[model samples]
Target: MLRRLAAALLSVLLVVLAPVAAQAFVWARSSDALTLDPHVANEGPTVALIQNIYEGLTERDRAGRLGPLLAVSWRMLPEEPTVWEFKLRGGVTFQDGSRFSADDVVFSYRRAKQPNSGFSDYFASVVAIEKVDDLTVRIRTRGPNPAFVENTPAIFIMSKAWSERNGAAQIPDNATTDANFANAHANGTGAFVLVSRQPHVRTELRRNEAYWNRGHVALGIANLTYRPIPRASARVAELLSGAVDFLQDVPIQDLPRLRAQSGLTVTSGVENRTIFLGFDVASQAPRGTEAGGRNPFADLRVRRAMNIAIDRDQIQRVVMRGEALPSGIIIPPLVNGWTGELDTPPPFAPARARQLLAEAGYPEGFATTLYCPNDRYVYGEETCRALVLMLGRVGIRVKLVAQPQAEQSSALRRTPGPDLFLAGWGSPTYDSEQVFSSLYHSRDGQRGAYNATGYSDLQADEMIGKLSSEIDGGRRDALIARLWQKLRGDLIYLPLYHQMLSYAMKEAYDIPVDVSNMPKLKLVAAPTR
Candidate 1:
């Protein structure tokens, strides 16, 4: 009788404290972040989640403008334009109370350039990093790189002492299912601290009371929880039932019902990303294709036929629910050097596509596989199904293989991963050179991390190499235009459309949509009830 009475009293006391905990912000999305290590993956969702826990020297604001995060000021050397100096912010401390200094900056640069790091391409031009003093550091590049600063936002800094002490000196290779100290743990100077993480289940974070920029930014959230709900309807139900405070990537089919709800606010924006299809053009006989002895994609006529078979306008209307913008170029219009002339896509002609396929020695067409992620992007699986049907009409039998983004990414990095794959590209630097060098350029040690198609051109590579050092505006723009013209004639990729993002939240809070799709919780504001 005594034990039962005590248990009942404790349960009643816990019920009273549950509502206070519900005040914590719950952010729901379709999938979980791949890793907590910032330098491991360059993917958008991974970076967005890591940005809240880790910070860089410079950051982009909600308006996509350059702003200070860890560095107070930075300038290029007058005598040596290839060298840039940055002055670190003093009195800043990491979450573990470690002092922030130039040593950490230098250490991070070195770590990010390691062979296992996927972000080595961003630092390809960086030759050396030197610490002049505790608060001053200089970085020397191989050439006068005007886009160096623009790329800094993606290079997050880590605590050198913490990493070395925890035996996490190197980034974990994300290809294999390897375990490391930093894979599920985090140590940073950002606005949030990781409290707990259960992969594919949930991640919990609490506000950092000692955050350096607490006074400069508005951090209304006291606690944050990220829950991955793969089912679209379940994610929507969570928001409608008041179980979640915010929902990112709202499905297009549910927009009307969500907008009519009383306590919900939905905001829409055009993201600076392009969805496209790539092929293994350089292979003699691409893997997992019906063509036994020859690669059909090697012929330009076959590539053009594949491009003309798809209907981007119909995809924009039916699959995307009239929310996406039909695109012809891999780079969106928001990026620099985008022109209307190069953005025109080929008209959908099934008869022409069939004729071209027969002329290219594939009279009966061929069987191939299209690897796609079901939960990574909005309607990713649905889009693939539509393409499979459209391609079948043109005598191409495409088998659709859908999996989680994590599994799909691992497959993409394997040796000759897929003959045909669906992927997306976003220029974090907001420049054409980043897209050109990484996607269009030939795969090498320093560049083309995502060029799984083996697409390479000597002329394109030469122009892309010159772009790193070019400073004149007119000359840079001219090179970009010429490169686009060359790529258009080659038909390297089948451009689909620019994605439109929808974010829904409770009416009591206001959160603006960012073009990069990184919603900083520091910008979220809540009104007192």
Candidate 2:
């Protein structure tokens, strides 16, 4: 009888102490990081995941404003108008205990500009990265760059000693299934240290006891576990069952249900990502299209027709559950140089679409494959399905080919990608130059890495190139507006809408929803009960 009573008492004590002993935060999302190497993949999930481990020269605050991280302060060189200097934060140590210095910044800059690194485009204007001293570094650009300062946050800093020792000096290209040590492992000087990672399964991170900003930031959660739940229903179920504490991408259909659940909070805001459709405009004979020996998308009339055929308002209502903001341009409002007048989507008119198609020599419309990802964007498959029906009404036959995000991204990067495909873009720099340089400019070694559409114009390229070096804010914005006007007139892409992001978490935790959809775990705070 004494033994039984003691055992029962121990069990009750464990139950009472479990919550306090294990203050872990489990976050679930639809997809996993393709690579932990910050320079390998310029993807949202990959960047967000690695951000917890990697520390950049600069970072964005909770309000999305530029702030200090690895670098304490930075300023433009007055004598050399094209140069910027950064003072590295002293007394900082990498997770492995190596002292942080300017050498690591220079090495990281060179590594990030390698051919395999997807972030090379961001540094296209950089002429040189030099170490002035152990604590100071300087970057010389081709010309005055207004966006350089804000763009630093995207370039993650890696320890030179750690990377060289691990044979990860070069980032493996994730597109070709190339694997390097950095692809699966990480070493950084951030608030969190990577404990373990199982690709497409789960990733575990523990608080860094030696974090430089320990008391400066709210580091309530001691541990974090990330689970990739591809299915929306499964993610919702995990959250509802208390198996997960936070969900990054909440489906619009479940917002109300999640909001009504006791002890749950759903924070929502418009994301910086703009979802749109692109075509192989430069391909002479694109595959998966009814047009033989020619590309129908090459015709302005057909492109305009396709643009008007998409009923953004209807998609926003039916498919998105009234959680999307319909847009006419690929750039979101959060980005610099965005104007409301320029973002007005074309009116949905099937009759007009048919007439335009007739004018483009496709009187009876044409059949084409619409490549989409099933799990990439929120309701991505459903959005493609709705697009198919909308185009069908105007006599366009759309064969929907929905695949996983990994496969879709691979296909889009190929020389001749799908004839028509859906893609979502987020401006990490929050600038129009990022959109123009990556999506609209002509494909080159430095720019147009994501221009799957094959849309290239020399004038557009020149304008974007000038926008990068233009120092005057008003002049740069005017150039941006001019480039946007040109893109609008050319109809290079069919703009859809800016995605609406909803983050569901326990009410005890207060997590702010940022436009980038990247919530820094260290900034998350849970009020004491």
Tens-place lDDT per residue, model 2, 1-529, is: 9999999999988776553413678999998888788887788888888999998999986557888888989888888879999999999999999999999999999999776567777887888999999999999999998688887898999999989999888766563477878887888999889989998999999988899998898777788998999999999999999899999989889999999989999988888898999998888888899875779999999999988889999999999999889998888888887899989999998899999999988998889999998877988889999999999999889999998887787776667778999999999888888888777777686788777888878888888888889999889888888988989999888989999888999887878787788889887764454
Task: Report clashes for each candidate as comma-separated counts.
Answer: 0, 0
* Local distance difference test, candidate 1: 0.86
Clashes of 2: 0
Q: Least lDDT summed over 10 consecutive residues: which range in candidate 2? A: 15-24
- Candidate 2 Cα outliers beyond 4 Å, as residue runs: 1-22, 173-176, 526-529
Q: Give the 10-residue window scoring lowest on summed lDDT in candidate 1.
A: 14-23
User: What lDDT does each candidate get?
Assistant: 0.86, 0.87
Q: Which pairs, if any, clash in model 2? A: none
